[model samples]
Target: MTIFGEIAQITLRALLGRRRTLLMLLLAAIPILVGLLVRANARPGPVDVGAFLDAIVIRVVLPLVALVFGTAALGSELEDGTAVHVLTKPIRRSTIVLAKITVAGTLTAALLVPSTIVAGMLIAGLLNTRPGSDPITATFAIGLGVLVGSYLYAAIFVALSIVTSRGLLVGLGYALIWEGILAGLLPGSQVFSVREYVRGIAETLEPSSIESIVGSSAVAYAAIALVTASVIASLRLAVYEVRGGE
Candidate 1:
């Protein structure tokens, strides 16, 4: 295999081998199962699928799952000294970071996107028959939002792991406080919020009457953040101090 592929493969295996993969899978199921239950209950009211996608799936679940996968992909390796083995290889440090983040982002999307789609579909079925809204558009928008959100967050968390041993705690704080509470409540802070960027992308696609905060500019911001994080992570890995497996 090529260098990127090799690193990606190892990262994927390491992530999947952990019990957290199963836990993430179960977490992904939450929206799907809830949608099914809500559908079975038989109600022709305003389902507000867009709201659910914003508040629950994208805001809460996507970040949580990305936190686990992104940090663990690199954090555990660095902590246990396995990362030193990869670092010793005659490979570009950027390539190593790229591979690991790629696998993490891909795996995160694979896990969360389908669940978002299925849940959207269920909610669409429940809400479509009512009136003025199109659930398919909402579902497509939410799916795209989840995709962008997952990858962006993965890149960021990967960089965070490189910078600190307490990356998980830091990531959780960013997710809960910075993105979750501050971003939503403070208009000025939305400029720095990842969730707002994700929601902006979704709103651009489907025009949510409720969560329309940012514009297409959100996409630009997200792209910039992803690239910046990836570059910083590569730089950190290049000169990273290794304790020889401690």
Candidate 2:
């Protein structure tokens, strides 16, 4: 089989693994549940639809979910020595890493895009009931921002899974400490945080709402930097034996 074919086989085999299936199903449900809850309640408030969606689902929910699934994407394989099966294949080591990253990133994007949309519809429905608001357009924009941001970070998270055995713990720290707390307080730190970038793209959906929190040029550059660096690191690290399976 060719590289793409091999990749497809690897991806499908990996997805068919027991744990990944459960993870996929659970991840798919997160946004749906959130959407249902939001649509069921929460009276309309005087906030930009993009900003509100970003604060709740984009910034908080998606990142946390990405950390969980992204890390598990390759991290579990490494921990269990399952990655050895792929590494020993006829394909180049780089292909193994790329294939795994593809699976993880694609799965993450699938979950986040649809889930965010579901949640956005819920939010939009509530906002639509109010006077003088275009919740659908704003919610649509928010979903776009979240999709871009999630794809970029999903790649980074997949790479990180290769480097660290404790991917989950470190990923959580990256999400909470680096993106959540420190990025706001420190200068130049905006270059590292994915949350800020998501917020920036999200601000495009509503400028004034998140202008105070996330910068435009800075967030854009940050997303590029994070994705590039992570890709490079993962490609390089793929040379090493992941778990040295027997």
Candidate 3:
């Protein structure tokens, strides 16, 4: 296998081999279970389902899962002193950081995207419905949003891991305190929250509705630009840190 492939394989094994993977699986299941309950008890409409997805899955679960996987991708290696061995290889530091973040993002998307889609479908009652409908389109829009959020969160957390040994705790604080509390309470803080960006993308993709609970098209465009910049900046920082060593 190629060096990138080898690094990705090792990262994947390390991530899945941990007991924490079970916690991640449980986190991924929350939306699905909530969907079932909503479908059974509330008999929710599309708007209700969309609101639930925006509030719970995209805003809360996506960042949390990404935090776990992203920090652990390289942070665990660094913490346990295993990363020194990898650093001694003849590979470019950029390549190592890229491989680790790629694996982290892929795994995050794998776990959360399907869960988001299944929950949206269940809550919107799209299982037996035909394609090309608004509900189906909306359900898919949420899935797409989750996919984008996964990568963005992974990139941010992976960079954090390179900079600090306490990446997980720091990521949790960012997720809960900054994104969850401040962004919701403060007027302008949503501009800095990854959750808002994800919600903007979903709202932009879904069909227009008066009851839309997420962001506007302007926010979506901003999200695209900001996410691109964040990913590039994060990779650059991670590469620099890896090259500099501890």
Candidate 4:
């Protein structure tokens, strides 16, 4: 019925943009490839989850995907001035924000779960190849962590895309500086880090299989704060103006 509504509809469609579509595929493939590599080298049994999660998910994949999808959901459109075309309508800005968030969040979650599972299976196979560790639980634990963590991170970044033009650059700083450095090196910062919560949830879900980086309650609160703030902030930042959001 309106410009935002029509464009929102386009973005919501699975095949709205080819560039974003290809990026999503590449993102999904990373985890799967890692899983295959691990499995090929060993057997799918018990996995060395700490090393795997730290190196694969935390160190590399998650942040990169967050940067790409989060920015692409809104930043790219803003940069290209395409956002102006849509905002020229009668639709509520809140609806447009929600639509963008939905697109980015869905892409992250849908791709992350399967990739984590595949990787976990491979790592587990390797650890159990010698017949000592419990590999079966590894897959479930990692998959569980991937699911919620992806959702949390995606939502946070999707909202972030609104506040900054350099979405990927800022997201990189968020991942490397906040999540990677400060959270890892300082216990004090852990209280405020989103990853702290993800690590906690992952541990809670994996209970016997993995040890979380922080306490459960702390992580729970941090996760909720990140998600809620992202949504609320994005809503407030909405500029109903048709041009430059001015």
Q: Model 2 misses residue 157 by how many Å?
A: 1.7
Best by lDDT: 1
Write the residue-wise lDDT of candidate 3 on 57-127 in tens digits: 87788999999999999888888878878877787766777788788889999999899889888866734
Per-residue lDDT for 79-191 in model 2, tens only? 88876666677766556555665666566667777777776677666654444556676566566666766666666777777777887888888888888788878997776
Clash pairs detected, candidate 2 = none
lDDT order of candidates, top first: 1, 3, 2, 4
lDDT of 4 by residue, 1-246 (tens): 755456556666632468866876787788778778776776444457545765677556776775677667666777777777666666666666666766665666677767777776666655453244355565576566666666666667766667766667888898889877877787777766666665666666656545555756745675577558566645754652333544
List model 1 lDDT by residue over 38-157, tens digit each. Answer: 789856567788887776688788999999999988888999988888888899989988887888888888988899999888878774443666777878887888899888999999
Using TM-score as the measure, the top candidate is 1
| Residue pairs of candidate 3 with colliding backbone atoms | none
Any idea what lDDT model 1 has?
0.84
Clash totals, every prediction: 0, 0, 0, 9
Candidate 2 local accuracy as lDDT?
A: 0.66
Model 4 error, position 18 (Å): 3.4
Number of the candidate with higher lDDT, 2 or 4: 2
For each candidate, the alpha-carbon lDDT, in order, equals 0.84, 0.66, 0.76, 0.65
